[model samples]
Target: MRRIVAALGASLLAACSTPPPPERGPAPAPAASPPAMAPAAPGALLQREAAVWRAARWDELPGWEADALQHAWPALLAGCARPAPGWEPSCASARALDSPDANRVRAWLQQRLQPWRVEAAAGRSDVRAEGLLTGYFEPQVQASRKRSAAYAVPLHTPPADLATRKPWYSRSEIERLPAAQAALRGREIAWLADPLELLMLQVQGSGRLRITEADGSVKTVRVAYAGSNDQPYRSVARWLVERGAFTLEQASWPAIRTWARANPAQVPELLASNPRYVFFREEPLPDPTIGPNGAQGVALTPGRSIAVDRRAVPYGTPVWIDSTEPQPWSPTPPPPRPLQRLVMAQDTGSAITGAPRADYFWGWGEGAEDFAGRMKQPLRMWVLWPLAHTPGDAKPISTR
Candidate 1:
């Protein structure tokens, strides 16, 4: 019945599956051990998550999203031993390197990356022309001497690119969606943001997204995308209803679109009002806890996917991203051979799981962040294990 809402959930649904198994039954009531530290509050949890994501200078550092996903996807995939359907239980399979999950995912992703006309006709997800904006992220670049962390640089674009706001949906991999590309042909979606492979629609660029800590220290972040490839307008309106925005009748796509268009300048205001929209991306473990690791993580140059083996690929491990998006996205040139790196798969979302299935971090820039939210396509990944395999790497924790 609904189109966009389904579109919105499509991405996230692929990453996180149903809530994780309830802690293997609560640790047998903790055996009356010494009292543990108080758990984090929802707000606090979110704040902590935000603070962790903000690298030295700019909030939307290139590989931050990748780092975040690197933190959580493995666990989720390890947990999702079997893939199921329906909202009740999360659906995912342990796609080990060269496993069936790997095969299916890679094959599907291969089709997705192809020309829109060929694959667009095949039902998959969807994309539409939108605006673009400059995305910025500071990595540790070289200087007079050795390596060091540096502030983010301005990866620029005009405001119009960050202003265009429409998600184009393709039909099923078996059938075309909305089949409106012809009407919407040649539409350029200058979409950008910190994508985690799913739900990229709502995170539209509005205001400055800053990560503030308890002590009042702040790291201001400029997101990249006008990311609206989220769930349908109705879904957002429904979420709004949950947050006391409107009545059921008003929670329709038409109503929401009209309202969104009417209050164009206020979209950020409306979006910010919904707490559901206020989400925190999580990073993988052994996070270096903000030490001066200056971890060299990978950069998600547009149209690319990085790999991670939770046990193997440590977070903040910067690696060069490799993709065949041809020119435009990738200037200079790609290596004669595939170049892979250990990026800081720092964050995690509800959807991203499986060993091969990766979270293409879209960083926190306005446009980039929005674009990252609604991305729900299967991605192929080749986790770059160390060139010189270590003893411990041999017996990697069973991601089965």
Candidate 2:
């Protein structure tokens, strides 16, 4: 689950867990950790390209003390690998922290960070804190090196002339034309059985392939984003809604898959409805437990990494997000589960454009995919900046 760049243009991934489930029993007394920088006090209102930030006390953040931040420790450390401007001092101190205790981590953060409530810029009017939260996941699909009855669809590397042509062939043209097919001939990295899964992989921008090689050895590899055909992206989910296949509220991935099964003949047409096509290049997977690299160039932590607009929140910043888990649309929908917790801003997405918007990273697997697919919830966020620097002194880290 990297910086997917779009929620509707391309779906962001999400998952079920948040901050490793709070530590059981009462919180212990703060334990001593490595020395940190002298805490600088927080400041007042600040403005960014599309957001407004108001300095706030930690108590203002919901579940601030309740979250077991030890689970978020890995993500914090990961972000430090490429610390943003004004983050060097904090990152240095963070690297010295060895304890995984909830109280200890909490104390470290409180000592060195300032919480700022994020609000959307409302064009010379008041600021609004509420924003959208979506989820993204790294899809894991079974694949084969060679085409077979079970694995017929091909996932390819970039075509030879992919860059020569601006806005290359549409997905429908690629599937329907021989010249387009010829350009991709013998370029297949692996073949998959379910076209829908392949489409999901493309939409998600990256995936894990459990590939059976031609020599009969099987290994899991990551198929990362190489390039796209540069076509305009259209949402298949929206297309389904327009065609009366499912209502807007019911257009989740599961529902789409169900509709595909019932109307097998229409599956191709349904998939082709989204003209955008993505290409991939496989990478070696040495660590299965670790997640895919985000836009920050660090491996994502399950339930801990988030995709945010760089304009509002810088990469590597710790964010305290207050939101509820995805709720069903049915009459008997379950109670709203609180999704408040500490997360790292390590990625960004295309649809993740304003100050309040975010795409939660759910890591990988079927459970992640399912949860991420259904995650479209209201979000409120607070960015934790290093207390040592004022908002005026801190600059957003450039990914370009």
Candidate 3:
């Protein structure tokens, strides 16, 4: 089965069967029809069911020429591996180039693709060109192959009767109920020393584990999202904020982890604040640099892969982002820098919807964690559609 790819980085969470709640940005006023004007030129108004794509010149994309297209080449090629409809010819041309030259890549893209400014379609509740941009990353945590006094927290596979149990068990009940425990008994894939890390794993839906086997051998592996207990997802960070543990603006993952450490006695209660429970399936991690496969069934390229609303932007399409880097987690951090760049629409999340919204993938490790944890910013997007295909030829109407 294809692996589940989901998340809304920082303090947000998503997974199969359980997606994070809709991300709410400023509620823009509904768009009004423009005053009578001359007919739009051919290829000007490219309309999809949920979005309006206005034909745009490449020059309109901020920082388009300045971007190092070579860095984005691999992600473009990766998306080509599972070419979306109308992307075959472009994919064929891309694979034939086989060169990583920045100039060549830039020229190829300019020659083969057209830019389209994305906006929420008229008649939508909130119609605007700007939208929310968040970030997500694969987490790396320590683990043990077998249960031990130190590594007592077990990350399990789906319960044997997960299917028949309807909503199965809440996170709290799974820990306290005998029936729930019995159903999950003997299903442990690995054990972690920290329950908060386990929660982190569950929230991200998938993560990397550096495991110590009984023989003292250490190796790394990936835990992919297998399934989830059917339950409503509540934000634990919000839970803390409501209880005055911290202000909502101070609810970064690092802050949460610090709170967990200082309040170890309440860790279980904190974990149970949200009722959702996620299950995992372990897989080999032969290459540490490559990321887990996204919903597109292709290994994601760090920094270049973005999770988008497939209803607005088709999978495999190249997107140009005009946003800023996340503000630092420090109290007196400097202002954010411009983060304009080229990215690919290779994945999706429950919370990621709308033409202009996106979730940037920051890869893995400590640095990635810091960046992704604070990456909620305003954004604008322009899709690079293949010149060979008209907007109508692309399938962004519905995934169903």
Candidate 4:
């Protein structure tokens, strides 16, 4: 019986191991490999360090047909004065343009330039087309040549030893230290009534001052960014939020001013939260219509000049922006009111980083201020390059 049981178990194991009958059908063909990407055309200027550069057509650009190209001519001319790499041909064509007609400018650009869409490189963790667009403008503020009962806040020029020092006196030190104050005693370019205005001027890096001289003669002049103390910048608004005094959403300039007015004793502490201080040099207003000098060392054109990351987009590069004027009251994003216009990358800011981020330069005065203060919008950008110019040996990979 034991022998029979063992034999039965062996038979069961053999049956379980037996293979099934094969199906009556032909085998499927081997999976094909994906098609290889096409190589870049000859003479393409590829920024290998950047995210990605994909060739694009003018027709593909949103609102291209509707943009007033003539309005950007002055800015184009200004950029030509300090042209970026491969911009010589385009700049020459721009310089030769005699007509200010929108159609003419549009035709000229269409003929000479190729638009390229900039996007995040493949395998990048953050891959997106949309970015943040903010606004900056030249502020027009009241000032005086000499400090008085009302105009107490002084705007100082950079000291001779500014370069020699690793980091100079901070906002609070300049106000409290006798030696620091002595270094800037005779270097007062102008004085303003509100300390916050002076702080804002420093933050903006440049502004137009409507001044009343000691002799009571009035004139408007520009105070351009001369130097800084080489210290890191700290935001007072962030400090306020960290201290639990106010939320981040309630840290607007007006809100801060209100807080300062209510707590006059803490004003100094509030101002001192920011360690960085900027110095300015007075400049003549050659063209009242044109804005102050930007980082590209040319006069910025209203609505056509932008500050971008130099690492991503070189200075003087033509950038097409697709953004909208922000609506502060709306909870939902407003319709894509296309600001799909040509703008020059002529400036940069500490806060303006990444490939797509930009700071649109709105000209001067209260209207500009209002626009700039309220402008933080979603944006997409395209860089326009000369079709005739291209990288010598490097092959560009098609992102599409």
Candidate 5:
């Protein structure tokens, strides 16, 4: 009996190990490999942008650009025909848009943009704040040589800006608009940035008042305003853990928010212990004026961060950003490259609060939020600040 049982077990194991036969129907095809793609880099982005700028301004290209388009347009167009995914190479192959036509397009774009001057005030170079350093904004072009007074103290405790939308209590008019809640939630976004970035937003109010005495007396104690800033989620959480707000493992958003709320006054102190960063986002960004792969407005899709060599960086330039960084978001697409290179720098947030810094534009949703929260790495890039210009005064590189 023992010998028979041992033999039965071996036979069963063998039966299980045998490969299953293919189905009677046609066999399934093997999984195909994704198309080959160039690894995304800032340099690649700059090259594409430089090419277009040179090509688009074919007439104005002074040096090598004019030569490339004249003699090498054919090969270049061929190389660009099979433009990689998310990259729109249509501009490159715009049906032989000879010099005159290309120059026309270039001229059209230049005319569309308006340059405004930031009138300086004759006040002291340094102004006093409640405690920390702060800034006052003047968005409009003034007539006289002075700053104007159309400011509001951002609801945010840290210094805040007018354009920087906040979840206004709306309690005042909440009953009127039912759709307001959804609209507010829709705009909620998150991003990751460096800790040490300085983001100082301010308002032009004399000071806030408090009811210290009873009856008819009130106190006019000055309130110091702080910029609305975020500690890269990672950095902020780490600080929280060190300060006994949470344990290393217990560090989490909900936990952090709760602790932060409980010690509202301590929130700034907690965040300041680490490097603080300001937020940046594109304004008038209903649609992007530029993108990674030369897409036009509204068509501005998401892209990864690319390091630019500031010397060549240009506003509204297209670029391909590698989309490979994995987090609590998507299962990480095979290394992201050249999805788009963001050219605008006036967005909100801390890490990106510098001129030289590029806030990689990760489109909407939770994945972007997760990416922004956990992000904290240096990137390499190919900058596309315009190389050839007729006479455009570009914004200076951030002096952070």
Candidate 6:
């Protein structure tokens, strides 16, 4: 499958200032009859349905006053570098503020933005704006510069002629075919131990690799989404579930590893079930604090960056998420706590297709992985846009 590649950088400001107005000419005469209703422009209607956007008061946004807005400051600023339409004014104002104070940032947002509640399209009795919320994170894996007995699996880079072919080669073909093997002979970026871990990294699109160098010096580097063969993606876990190896609820990284250990002979067949293959490129870790590039071309914030459907919520827009922690699937799940907070629509994913769906970024390492792996719960969202911004002819029901 072809994965999207995004650029990362830091360059955003807070929305504490106002933009200059556009120069206008003399007012025109009133229309003799009400103007005919015009067709909506591109990206006007949310999801091309009757999705109602009820304007909300600031107080209606749950936990708005208590959230630590400073955490999302970096993500907002990075998005400002490539501000979207209807967002340029707010981005410009934000560029002028340098302070990272949470109170000041929260105040600026309250002053300039109008929050709208996303509702299901009218007449669709079965639909509701509320949908599933999940999480994804950058995983850290151990690797080596040279292919050793311990680290036998190799992570390949895109070949010189990768773009020339429509679908390069399937994962099985690459391992079995001579021509496919030749194409990736010298394109190894790094070697890893577990094939399952490498596949997980590819599925997530990006991750951090902890490598031991030739001289025994260890260093950490980012392996971001470079490109992939255009084959379709299939879930091996789903395959396991269908085969009765485990139930859907019991499917996870640890469970999969246990299955692999029990059925060592089926490892190759399990991997070959999915035809898609991903190639990666190493990136420099300039600022260890920042994360890999998101679809909006900005560095993601640990708790404040979320992947949203671009058609429903435009990139660079502020989104308020009201959800609960996912229920644990084991001996005991974590207590269901409120996950209300402010986050930015700074990324996107193929699976995130609807308006209410979102994938929260939880940063990197084990803690993030643990949370991200289990985050699948119901979600409600409120989009904060510039007060003057309007999607189409839809007027705000109320304003704060």
Best by TM-score: 2
**lDDT: worst 10-residue window of model 1:** 45-54
TM-score, each model?
A: 0.27, 0.86, 0.85, 0.82, 0.30, 0.81
lDDT values, one for every candidate: 0.26, 0.76, 0.74, 0.68, 0.26, 0.69
What C-alpha lDDT does candidate 5 achieve relative to the native structure?
A: 0.26
Tell me the tens digit of each residue's lDDT in model 6 across 188-297.
98999999878777766688899989898999998877777778766677678789987666655566789999999999999898787878888888788888877676
lDDT of 1 by residue, 42-136 (tens): 21110111111101211212232233333333433322222111101111111332333434433322222111100111111331111111111
Question: 28-61 in candidate 4: lDDT tens per residue?
Answer: 2233222233333432334445445567777778
In each prediction, how many residue pairs overlap at the backbone (N, C-alpha, C within less than 3 A)? 88, 10, 0, 3, 42, 3
Give the distance in Å from residue 298's predicted Cα in candidate 3 to where it truly belongs.
0.6
Q: Give lDDT tens digits, candidate 2, residues 1-400.
A: 3422123212522211111111122222243343355532344666787787777888889988789899999899888777777677677777777776899899888888888888886754566889888888888899999899999999998999988998999999999999999999999999999998888887776789999999999999998777778776567787777788876666577778899999999998987877778888888999899887777777788799888877888878999999988766786898889999999998765456787888888888757876777778888999998776755533342223
Please rank every candidate by lDDT, starting with the best.
2, 3, 6, 4, 1, 5
lDDT (Cα, 0-100) at 162 in candidate 6: 86
Candidate 2 wrongly placed segments (more than 4 Å): 1-43, 390-400
The numbered model that scores best in lDDT is 2
**Candidate 4 Cα errors over 4 Å, as ranges:** 1-45, 48-51, 120-125, 242-251, 330-336, 391-400
Model 6 lDDT at residue 276: 77
The TM-score that candidate 5 achieves is 0.30
Question: Residue 294 in candidate 3 has what lDDT?
Answer: 71
Which residue pairs overlap in candidate 6's backbone?
A: 12-77, 13-94, 14-94
Question: Which candidate, 4 or 6, has the higher lDDT?
Answer: 6
Is 1 or 3 the stronger prediction by lDDT?
3
Model 5 stretches with alpha carbons more than 4 Å out: 1-238, 241-255, 261-268, 271-301, 304-312, 329-350, 353-357, 384-400
Candidate 5, 1-400: lDDT as tens digits: 0000101111100010101111222222333222233222221111221111111222221231221122222322322333222212232323334563434433422332211111111122331111111111111110111112421111222223323545332322322455534433322121112111111111111112232233445333222222222222124555666677755433333455578667877765654443322222222322222221211111212332222222233323333221224233234535532221212221122222222223343333335323333333223222222222221423222212
User: What does candidate 3's lDDT look like per residue over 83-182, in tens digits?
Assistant: 7776776676677785668899888777777788888876534558897777777889999988889999999999889889879899999999999999
Give me the overall lDDT of model 3.
0.74
